[model samples]
Target: MTGFDPAAHLSEKLLERIRARAAAHDRENTFPAQDLADLKDAGYLAILVPTDLGGAGLGLAEASVLQQRLAGAAPATALAINMHLVWTGVAKVLADRGIADLRFVQEGAAAGEVFAFGISEAGNDLVLFGSDTDAAAQPDGAYAFTGTKIFTSLAPVWTWIGLHGLDTTSPDASKLVYAFVPRSEEDDGRVVTRDDWDTLGMRGTQSRTTELHAAIAPADRVVRRIDPGPSPDPIVFGIFSVFEVLLASVYTGIARRALDLAVQTAAQRRSKKTGKAYSQDPDIRWRIAGMALAYDPLPAELASISRDVDGRADHGTRWFSLLSGVKHRAVTMAKRVVDDAILVAGGSSYFSSSELGRLYRDVLAGQFHPSDPESAHATVASAWLGPIEP
Candidate 1:
């Protein structure tokens, strides 16, 4: 519940494994098998678990720090791990009332199985907007979830799923609660992911779409009722902040790799006009410096918000709104920074051979997650006054 310093808690042995896997994992677009195994063995997947339980009981601040460091090298691995951790994090949010399947997710986190969220929909620009999809309650103590869910990352690699859906009949949107379910079913595939993730970005993420068209058994449903109307204000806004922080970490890591690779490869890049090290060229130096200018100062700024969020201190109209502003700023800055890295790294940055290229693609995907800058900014502004619509 307290006194957890994620900066200090990170295991060097585990990091070495993540670093070791960074190349081949990204290259082959293979699963981050080692990183996931290491994280599970380390028991970090139980992060944010209730203090009453035997968990470390850490806060978002600690988790964010770990994510920033571990993910920067291998985002695919970091993100795959996050699928479980975020599910763990959100499960705790709903824990007060008791989500029956939660204990399963908790034990799974400890035992090495992971649960992923199924929210995105097909044809949606930014995920988290909820699908045009809808659900209905049935007589069998279950609901027939018969809509498509897009961008369900880690689907191929997970054991359980946490999903959010809409019940058109609800009176309030906040009532649209999140639920937990299994990835497999002898009855039918309660959850299924489409194989549409083959792309130029986040190759290994396996972020594909899914269709839920089976009986969501009663005891299996985490939270089945809702009063669909307006959105869950501070919670929605706060989730945005959480996502932005993670997205920024992904890009920052990519940019850091860009700089590192550029510096290392500079020596071999000779001038076309003259035989000279590219590292010594002023233009090349300036280009790389620009990336540095953008890369630094992001984490501390995100960290700064922790002081406000933890204390619920002075800020915008609501605690979450205040974080939204910071999230937007961090994401926007990361976008530009990586663009600069891409430009400086040259044509190579566009090829899979170059790590920066993959980094660039994954970072680009961050811009579209949950919501984009435009929607995020609008949401923050609306929050200054009150909750947002749509």
Candidate 2:
């Protein structure tokens, strides 16, 4: 419970190494394998697991801080790592609530097994509340999932994928099945990862499409079977809370980096009119100050909510709204800051080689993650005014 220091987990040296490779990975449209390797060596994948389980035993708050630092250096690396952390974070949440179904997730991560999130689907607006994938139940209480998942981050090296599908035939009929399936070639083509991750930004994430053809999760891996659409299941809460908060942390980190770059650019660039650093220019000073103003509140906000989650504060039904709201704000603020940074950095930022230009592209990815703008507003609106009338 002492003051948490992100540097202890992600050293400046390691981060600099990761940062140095970011543009190359982005340009090549490839995964940050060395970054992942370095993180694994640092035991970052197990940061959320309890110390008794051979991890750093940090809470979501600490993990959030660490993610921010990591993202500041190499956003795509931090983002891909977020998927692995999500499962471990969920395991911590479940363990905190006395649900040990996912204890193996904690243990697996500590042992170097990489877990990827696979919940997102194409055209499935219901999100965590619904699934387009089919979850056919087996007599032994296992389930076979069949569908395609888009934006499956860590697609290249994940050892296990945590995903969900709809169960329509079980007597529990119409329940959403949350399960984990290993990434094994022994499945004879049941699990397929598509090598198609070309995108405008966050290219190092290599988040590609995945096809599951009757991908089986043995009984032990079947974590939850809950009714779809806004249930009170701990799994739902754990996923929603951790996912949203970590996502916010990532974009907030992006904002922090953008603001820092703007400061550096302002300090280094000379204004022709005054022969002084742009940092002293009235307009440049105003823009940098404005960027800082926008960026200031994000870390505090992320810390407060993340601590609430770690402390298990009873936000009650307001949880969804609070989580989504922070994520939405962080992303929008990051985009604004990056845009202003581009202006302050002037024409140099327009080139693809500019770090600001790379950041400009990377920051755009924030809007596409879960609890998207429309959904975030809807969740908050429902918390305040209730659902729309049918």
User: Which residue runs does candidate 2 get wrong by more than 4 Å?
Assistant: 185-187
| Residue lDDT tens for model 1, 124-231 | 543444445556655654555667776676767777666666666544443454566566652376656667777666666677777777627355555545444435
**How far off is residue 75 in model 1, in Å?**
1.3
Scored against the true structure, residue 346 in model 2 reaches a CA lDDT of 92
Candidate 2 local Cα displacement, residue 47, angstroms: 0.3
TM-scores for the candidates: 0.80, 0.98
Tell me how far the alpha carbon of residue 173 in candidate 1 is from the true structure, in angstroms, after superposition.
10
lDDT value, residue 108 of candidate 1: 62
- Best candidate, TM-score: 2
Instruction: Quote the positional error of residue 224 for candidate 2 in Å.
Output: 0.6
lDDT score, residue 29, model 2? 97
**Model 1 segments beyond 4 Å from truth?**
1-9, 50-52, 92-108, 123-131, 139-141, 169-175, 215-217, 233-238, 263-280, 310-321, 343-351, 381-390
